[model samples]
Target: MADRPVPVKDLKLLDIKLGQLPGWLASRNYSPMGFVNGYRRGYNRFYSKYIDVKKGGIGGIAMLLTGYVLISYIWNYDHIKHERWRRYH
Candidate 1:
């Protein structure tokens, strides 16, 4: 449990709204099974929540990446400032 990044129960909650993909596609006159990807069905089922724009799927990933990058910048800034401070003093 200590080594696992996410629990099975938590992962199970990630199951969301994949059941509606086919109906949505059908309303638009598209076949759900017509997609070229062989694993599209499975992917659609698993990643439906992550693909929802309203759920912040891609945007959330980008914001998280940006936050970590800024944290890294802050961490490195002290070292650079220390070097400059030494040079000036």
Candidate 2:
């Protein structure tokens, strides 16, 4: 018989959010939905992250989204400031 892993909930809490999915992405699987869908796949595969966000899982996803957003924002801010200073110099 084929072996199947048990449901993710039954797995330790640490396993679902920060384990196999990130490892898989680091090794491969560059698809956009990879992490978000992985969350659903681990949870119950019943909820959509998009709808969840729309209904207000904002707090949950916010930190993840904000890191990427603020990174680009700060990079752009610094780049523009550097260019202005260079033009003045």
Candidate 3:
């Protein structure tokens, strides 16, 4: 049988005592190395999910390209309109 999911009420984020605050803060890595490692882990996850050709395949590439084109058009829409207006005047 599959294991049941834990209820959210069972987890306490703000219910910790003042005495545990120091230990809890210390346990979370706040160093530069920690930042670099965290960035790499996040990047790897993003690449695997959206950028890797073998994993995301052609659909991901097409989506990314289409999104880029759409954003570019939206960003330059005002300038394009101005240029067209100037050409007619």
- Model 2 alpha-carbon drift over 4 Å, by segment: 1-61, 81-89
Higher-TM-score candidate of 1 and 2: 1
What are the lDDT figures for the candidates, one per model?
A: 0.57, 0.61, 0.72
lDDT of 1 at 53: 54
Task: Report the lDDT of model 3 for residue 22.
Answer: 67
Whole-model lDDT, candidate 3?
A: 0.72
- Best-performing candidate as measured by TM-score: 3
Please give, for residues 14-87, the per-residue lDDT of candidate 3 as tens digits. 76567766665666567999899878976686668888755456766687689899999999999999988775
Candidate 2, residue 85: the lDDT equals 73
Residues 2-80, candidate 1, lDDT per residue (tens digit)?
A: 7756433233324425775554444432355554443575566545545555546466567557879999989999887
Global fold similarity of model 3 (TM-score): 0.41
Q: After superposition, how far is residue 43 of candidate 1 from its true place, in Å?
A: 23
Ranked by lDDT, top first: 3, 2, 1
How many residue pairs clash in each candidate at the backbone level? Answer: 0, 0, 0
Can you give the lDDT of residue 8 in candidate 3? 39
Question: Which of 2 and 3 is the better model by lDDT?
Answer: 3
